[model samples]
Target: MKIRISWQGKEVEIESGSPGAVLVEAFGWKDPRPIAIRLGGELLDLHSPLNREGEVEPVFPEDPEALPVLRHTAAHVLAQAVKELFPEARLGIGPATEEGFYYDFEVPRPFTEEDLEAIEKKMKQIVKRCYPLRREELSKEEAERLFSERGETYKVELIREIPEDRVSVYRQGDFVDLCRGPHLPHTGMVKAFKLLSVAGAYWRGDERNPQLQRIYGTAFFDKEALKAYLERLEEAKRRDHRKLGRELELFSIEEEVGPGLILWHPKGAIVRKEIEDFWREEHLRRGYQLVYTPHIALRDLWKVSGHLDFYAENMFAPMEIDERAYQLKPMNCPFHILIYKSRKRSYREFPIRYCELGTVYRYERSGVLHGLLRVRGFTQDDAHIFCREDQLEEEIFRVLDLVVYFLSVFGFEEYQIYLSTRPEKYVGSEEIWEKAEGALAAALEKKGLSYEIDPGEGVFYGPKIDLKIRDVLGRFWQCSTIQVDFNIPERFDLSYIGPDNRPHRPIMIHRALLGSLERFFGVLIEHYAGAFPVWLAPVQAVVLTVADRHLPFAEEVQRELSRAGIRAELDARGERLGFKIREAQVKKIPYMVIIGDKEVEGRRLTVRTRKGENLELGLEEFCARVRREIAEKIVF
Candidate 1:
């Protein structure tokens, strides 16, 4: 028999056998880098046999689609090493993540640092052995029997869930795993890898299920790439918000209060206030009416908004109050909808925007909660716009512009925007969904912005435009979202008198410029490394005296700054000027006004910036310069 292989618009006839044969003849055998074959759009093992003609493409190491495959192979290698080290270890699921891979195991005890070291050593040995990975297809009954004999209860359970009678499994040396895989030819292909850390994870992310030990690891195509990744990881550790939150005395999460609830310190609260004041002023200037709502509302309100049915999992349990059930608000949409319904509106009032810094509560899993990013209670910079159908596109354009402005002001110049369409189980009609999606796309195009379509990732109620800001370290944070909702308006019976003098449904747009103040603050902390710009800094300037005699002079300078609306402080401690300067630096203060005998006598201020720039100027000159820098929100 003959088989034809077509690649890059070229075709060749070869004797029927494995695709690996053609690749070896065309390229070479056992190349060091990750190289695989994609047959008719399905990724396949290079050794996968081909008995018929098909279009083939080579997946190189640099291809974006190849990293998941490489990481998955590394996961298999990790499992093999674990089984070798501890023969009694049983496996759970191992999957590839965005950054790397992780494998769960049901071991006698949690893995220790020493155990990870041993497992990594054994993985290296397996790579040296270059054991070939072979795939096998077996009937469900046979697969269950195979795993049962090996005491792999997890594998047996997994097999039972497979609908198809035939299941695929991969084996290397004495290790076997139930998987539908397109792995590398052998273990040697994984050139550079590292075992990062281990943590306890409930099976399948359910709190009711038994917890398993999960080992996280990463792999790269070469050693230098791996080295670069490790260095970035180190820098990330140095910028970790949790560490800096404490070291800089910004915020804290205390067990006495509760998990996922942040206790903002004085300095942190000052920063938050600055952000809130700026946000409110900008919204007011842009035609938004600020409003306030209660933290808890009657449960029927949620039912009307569809949150009770669709979002109950993330909501707190209901509290019964005087024969009525009340729930902590998980969102501000319902209240805003109620506000619109309070009075009959007119088309002339179209594009009515209501914004609030509303605090909301949700029940987050304890294990998944971080310091401030994944908090249970957070204040959202929430807004909702009610507009006519014809105004939808223009309103979206305005929201996108506002989102970009807010992110840019916070020093986020690079971002990734995604337009998410309707999901499978959605509330609105298909016609409305298509219209909303088209409006979002049109707005993006009108603004000359490029965005990717995230199919089936939108909320059940609406389509949305999600903006992810890339910080200084090249990490992305989901901060801003603009969603077009038709369901809530219909559910709430929100209507406006149109030009025809008839009541028509007003489409609602839900927006959050900063998704949550706590999360955004955490991102800001890490993004700027706690060295906030002067406008956002809690203490913009600190006055320090060179000697006890200059205390009066330092106090006067600080008072003048405070009068000028700058957040200034006076460090009047009985320590040396260098010690005081170091303390101010540690606090990440933007400016330091040093007063020595010469400056005190001359009635001048010596200004030192956080970046170590110094300038000797008259008091008035220094204040003017500082005000300009703060007003401009300069980075450094």
Candidate 2:
């Protein structure tokens, strides 16, 4: 049969009986391997037979589809190695995640560092053995019996939970797993693999379920790619925000203070204040009206907004006040919606943009919390745009432009944008969903930007456009989102008078350029390795005196820099020049103005950059250079 395969924009036709068979043959060609196969509108398995003509796209290794396959196969290799070594370990779920793959196992003891090393060694051996992977279909009863005969109770339990009568199992050598898979053809296909770390995870991700030891691992298609990834991981570790936060005395999460709660020290607060100032200026420039909302609102407000019913799980528990219940705001959408409903609006005033650095709270799972990246209380750089249907595309384009501009300022040039369409359980009407999704797509296309369409990956309320910024280590973080919500206006009964003087529901566009201030700050720390740009740096410059005689000059220079709006301080402590320089470098200060008797007498200051470059300049000239760099927001 003839089949058409299209990817990105290219298309080709091949004759084959099955998708996998066709790919196996096509792999011999110089074409990129498909990560997924789309037969008609359905995502079909690579192993599924193609009996008729249809469109197919090959998802290559760089495609998102390949990540899941690589991660899933890595999980299988992990399981096989575990069974070979421990023999008594009970398997639970092994699935691929956005970052990597993880497998949960109930073992007699938690996996030690040495145990992980051994397991990794065995996995390498399995990869070297080049065992062929074969899939077999069996009735649910037979699958359960087969697993039961092998004393794999977890596999039997998993099979029992399956609603289908038939199940698929993949076997390689002596190990077999009950999985619906399109795994690699053989173990040797896993070229670059590494076991990340071991952690405790609940079976099926349910807290009430028994906790199992989870082994996390990541794999790549080639050895060189793997080495690069490993190096990136090392760099990421060195740039970890948590480590930097502690070292720089920026923030703290105390055991007594509570988990998922951050205590911003003076240094951290300075950074935060600078960020807020920049945000306010940018929003004002972009025609956004800044608004402040309360941290807590009546419980009924959320109920009216539908968040209490639909988003209750993520919300913190309600508290009683004067025999009435109140809830901590989990999101700023409801508050912003209330602001729009406060007064009647005309069509001329339809596109009302309200922006806020709103602090919200959510009850995140304990095990999932990671420093500032995942927290309970965080501030969202949120904005809502209320506009007519005709203005939707223009507004989306504006938002997209703003996101690109803001991210570029932070040195985030590479981004992975995803436009998500309506899900099966979405609230909006089909026509509305279509119109909103089309507007987002049109905006992306108009800007000549490429984005992936995530069908059925949208929010329950409406479709959304998500932007993931690629960090220095090449990892993507979901930092920006622009969602079109038709349900909120309807549920809240929001309306604005149209050109015809008829009341019409305003199209609400919810957006967060930097999803959360706390999370974004963490990403920023890692992205720049704690050495912020002069414009955003908490302490942009430090004046270090070489000796007691230079202390007066250092203080004078510090005052001069401070007057020029640079965050400069004098290091007048009883320490040697080398110690002071070392201290400034450790703090990642962008610039250090070193003053000694020789330089002070000559009316010059020795300049040292964070990257270890040194220069000597007149005091007045140095100030001019610093001012220009700060004004320009130079990144180094």
**Top-scoring candidate (lDDT):** 1
**lDDT of model 2 at position 145:** 90
lDDT of 1 at 41: 83
Note the clash tally of each candidate.
0, 3
Q: For model 2, what is the error of residue 570's alpha carbon versus the real structure, in angstroms, after optimal superposition?
A: 1.2
- For all candidates in order, the CA lDDT equals 0.89, 0.86
RMSD of 1: 1.9
State in Å the error of residue 447, model 2. 2.7
Expressed as tens digits, the lDDT of each residue in 1-636 for candidate 2 is 677665445565776555454654554433654545655655444655566655555556776567677678789999999999999999998988866788999998899999999999999999899876666789998999999988888889888889998998888899999988867767887878899999998787678887899999888887787788888888989999999999998899999989999999998899888789878999999899999999998999998888878889899999999999999999898889888888889999858999999999999888889999999999999999999999999999999999988888788999999999989898868999999999999999998889999999999888999999998788899999999998889998899888798998889999999899999999999998898888888898999887788877788888888888888988888888899899999999989998888888898988999999999998788888989987777776
Models 1 onward score TM values of 0.96, 0.91
Per-residue lDDT of 1-636 in model 1, one digit per residue for the tens? Answer: 887888777777777866554665664434643367777887877766676777877788888888888888899999999998998988999989988999999899999999999999999999998988887889999999999999999999999999998998999899999988878888888879999999998887777887889999999988998999899899888889999999988999999999999999999999999899989999999999999999999999999888877889999999999999999999998888888889889999878999999999999988799888999999999999999889999999999999888888899988899999999998878998999999999999998889999999999888999999999889999999999987888887888998899989989999998899999999999998899998889889999888788888888998899888888988888898888888888888988999988998899988998889898999888888879987887765
Steric clash pairs (candidate 2)? 34-58, 34-59, 35-59
